[model samples]
Target: MWLTSKIKQLLMVMKPGVVTLNYPAERPPVPKNLRGQPVWDHQKCIGCGGCSDHCPSRCILTRDVCQELRVMLYDGSRCTYCGRCADICPEGAITMSNSFEIACDDKDDITTRLELFMMTCQRCGRCYEMEKSNAIDRINLKGFRYDNLEQRALVRTTSETFSPELLKESDNYKRPSDKE
Candidate 1:
């Protein structure tokens, strides 16, 4: 019975219906749903750090390379291809690509680098923006001009009005103590 079973196994192994491919020579068939690698678009990115926060392996690194510029580094070697980064990006900056061939001698080969310029408030000298984002630019372009002196004065007043001391000084502002 053992000899018959061994013969049957040999026959199955010798069957011509088996499908095989030479992997090194021919690219292996990748599934359509396969999330292979994450690609970063610096132009679309707003330096939000959403990808870094969502990354499971902690492959994304956001560092202040200089006072004027911020750098975001995506280390592919540490990535798990989880696609969380691509999903969580508010600006749609990150995307998953089909290219899985990331083998390299140098670690930086697969790294994606992005730089964002810091925008400072002209009046207050506060670094309000890490990057000159499109949304803010659009707002400014659509009538809200920060370069206008009147607009700047309005912004300053708006910010100062939020302060307790400033609110106390304002005739229109009534604090809880004043109301009591």
Candidate 2:
């Protein structure tokens, strides 16, 4: 009776034999709706910081180097792959790619850095419309952001214009201690 039961189990296992594929040599096709990794289109991106604001994991960072220059960094290591950045982006600049294998030794291998040069209006000290129909008007922040890229910290402060004082303050931002 034991031998018959063992034989029956072996027959069931043999019915679906050799289902595993040689991963490195023969890769499986990525699904159509896979939300793997986020890809950015710099041309379409206006450095609005919408993606940074919407990221649940806060992996996205934005730093305003100057009135004309803004630096955007996307750290894939801390990202939750929620696709919120892609969805919140007004310019459709962020897109989720099908490449899911992101294992790497160095953090820079998966990091994405973008330097966006903004054209500001001389009168208002605000970003000018890139196009007649461009949605630059929909940007949430009125002026500049001073996020710390070195510390990987997001500074929620903004200035209506280029303020060196605000930049200095952001540079000195300290994390709250548990003792406090």
Candidate 3:
């Protein structure tokens, strides 16, 4: 009885023989709608900070360097690839590419940085006002942001105008410790 059962098990295993592929040398076809990685189109992006705000993993970050310059950074190391940034983009600037093999030693290899030149109002140092009709544009940060890209930290603080005090505070931001 034991011999018969062993033979049956061997036959069952042999039925689905050699289903594994020779990976690294041979690649399989990518399936449809695979959310592998996020790609950004700098031309289409309006520096609205919408993607940064909507990112579930908080991998996308935005920093207003000055009144006329806004820097956006996307750190793929922390990204969950949920495709929220692509969907929330009003200008269709963000897209999910179908390249899934992203194993890398350096995090900078997957990091994306965008330096956008913004048009500011002469009277007020703020960015050019957007029309109120579009709700997507309204969901962005109104003032200045100072995210720490080197530390990969999102400083959840903003000011109506560029403030050096706020920038200094962000620089000193430290994560809470569990030891306390």
Q: lDDT at 12 for candidate 3?
A: 97
Worst 10 residues of 2 by lDDT: 128-137
User: To one decimal, what is the Cα RMSD in angstroms of model 1 from the true structure?
Assistant: 14.8
User: How high is each candidate's TM-score?
Assistant: 0.61, 0.79, 0.83
Residue by residue across 50-84, what tens digits does model 1's lDDT show?
Answer: 56645667667554433445566777877899998
**Which sections of candidate 1 miss by over 4 Å?**
16-19, 65-68, 120-180
Better model by lDDT: candidate 2 vs candidate 3:
3
**Candidate with maximal TM-score:** 3
lDDT ranking, best first: 3, 2, 1
Clashes of each: 0, 0, 0
Q: Each model's C-alpha lDDT?
A: 0.58, 0.82, 0.83
Query: Model 3: which residue pairs collide?
Result: none
lDDT (Cα, 0-100) at 178 in candidate 2: 92
Residue 66 local lDDT, model 3: 71
The digit string of per-residue lDDT tens for model 2 on 50-156 reads: 78876888889888887788899999999989998887777889999998999999999999999999887666575432332535434455567888877778887
CA lDDT, candidate 3, residue 107: 88
Cα lDDT of candidate 1 equals 0.58
Cα lDDT, model 2, residue 118: 86
